[model samples]
Target: MKGRWLVVPTVAAYATRTLRVPLAGWSLTGEAQGVGPVTRRVYWIDIASPRRPETEVVTHLLQHLPEMIPPVLAAFRRVRRGGGPTGVGDRFTVLMLGVRRGRVQVVEVDPTHFRLQTLRQHSESGWIEFRSEPLVGNSYRLTVVSQVRASSWYDRATYLLGVGILQRMTWESGLRRALKVSGGRKAGHGTTTVEWP
Candidate 1:
């Protein structure tokens, strides 16, 4: 039940975690509020399901996102801003690395997909989306997509340094967790793609 109340423990844990994320050739495609180019990263996993496992997993994540995040690496602390079941218009105050805090809002949502937009003062200016879609018989593709630019030159520098790699790892870990929690096996080898255009 780590949301707003359990932040201190996680922040304390951050001191021991090291940052050694591998680098990638991230594509900067779109304009970011005139600050810079947009970086797009996408991760997906194919789930072979006999029932509505995909929907159940999505609902679970929408209710408790911390389950998807890899605690050892990212250690991100997320707190809901409003009081009620998670849904559209929900806001989350994200504490990253126990050093920076940013705001993200649920801008759009549905049974199969949902989008979160980063608000002002956040490290990046863009949105990240989680979507589940039917690919064929008894299989679905769960995807996490993000397109954002650093909120400022300082943030961009840190991103290029290592934050970007950490972000990629976070989503990949989330996808794997979602797949495993869905009570399904991988329909095929998972894929991680970075798009620039």
Candidate 2:
């Protein structure tokens, strides 16, 4: 198991180097690259809670995301109605490590699920969804799924080397903190699973 674990970082380093080849001016169309147009990954945590409505849990999570996440890296807020299309088309922006990264549009919203898609030039492109599901007990499962494609080879390399890991760590920490602050105990360590397609 230790040797297997060690292979992860080694493979990551090799993949980063392999993807470092410049792809300047190259564009990626949504196509199957064995990873589809977007790579999909899921992260989830189970939080102990009273019998709360799924919508309440999701709403609370969304509203608290900005605060839960690392302040220096990202911030989120709902754009004013007059500023753009409201409701389902609501807009938001995310800063990557404190720099304006891209715009996001709320594409879908429901009591148990919310989805947002990137709208501007960004290192990665695609959508992310957050969902809440009732578990066997009074607790709930909060899951976040991200499907994105690297805009360039450099972006891909950066993701492989450190950015991806940082994002995962930040996300898991934020969720754990959010649960704790909301009077919920995390059932266990959050789990992140990556899928090529």
Candidate 3:
């Protein structure tokens, strides 16, 4: 069977009460960031939301690459479940709760290549649904892009700045955290790092 690829961007408003330290299980309060190794290249991802407001500042931690793939897989699971059967022309609803509430995008994932189609529409509780063949066994990469936006009228000057800064930071921090969690499950410990990509 031919494989189709769907690129669904799942953006959420999040608030983390504690910073999860990779492999250490150590938790920190406030805005703390996790750092880790993606092969020889070090990177990070950050998440900011009104729900988890305490994570406003940035700190550092360490992690590995093998640790970051599961959440991406999980994301696929959510989209698949919400949509229905994985097939061509299948439609689904995607729920995105963040700076913009009640925001949903209709998605169609082509089974042949997995390229996703999205449209802005309010859905049933902001659920994103789509149909596409399973990419679980297929060899491909999952890219996650998350950003935070805030405004207070007077502080609106830096609104765009916050998005750009947070997007890169959030992606890096999230990647590290994903690595630690995913890798820990694959391995008995977080110390054992492997090649990813």
Q: What is the C-alpha lDDT of each candidate?
A: 0.69, 0.64, 0.24
Cα error, residue 73 of model 3, in Å, equals 20
Write model 2 residue lDDT over 80-190, tens digit each, in one string. 444432346666656666533555677788788888776534556777788878888777777788788876665677778778887787677666765665467778555
Tens-place lDDT per residue, model 1, 91-134, is 66666655665667777777888888876656777888898888
The C-alpha local distance difference test score for the whole of candidate 3 amounts to: 0.24
On lDDT, the candidate that comes out on top is 1
Candidate 1 segments exceeding 4 Å error: 1-34, 72-83, 189-197
- For model 3, the superposed segments whose C-alpha errors exceed 4 Å read 1-98, 102-118, 121-142, 145-159, 184-197
Model 2 misplaced stretches (Cα beyond 4 Å): 1-37, 81-86
Q: How does model 3 score by TM-score?
A: 0.25
Give the total clashing residue pairs for model 1.
0
Provide the TM-score for each candidate, comma-separated: 0.74, 0.71, 0.25
Ten contiguous residues with the weakest lDDT in model 2: 25-34
Task: Put down candidate 3 lDDT per residue, 21-90, tens digits, no spaces.
Answer: 1243211211012112112112322222112121111111111111322333221122234533344343
Evaluate model 2: give its lDDT. Answer: 0.64
For model 2 the local lDDT of residue 185 reads 73
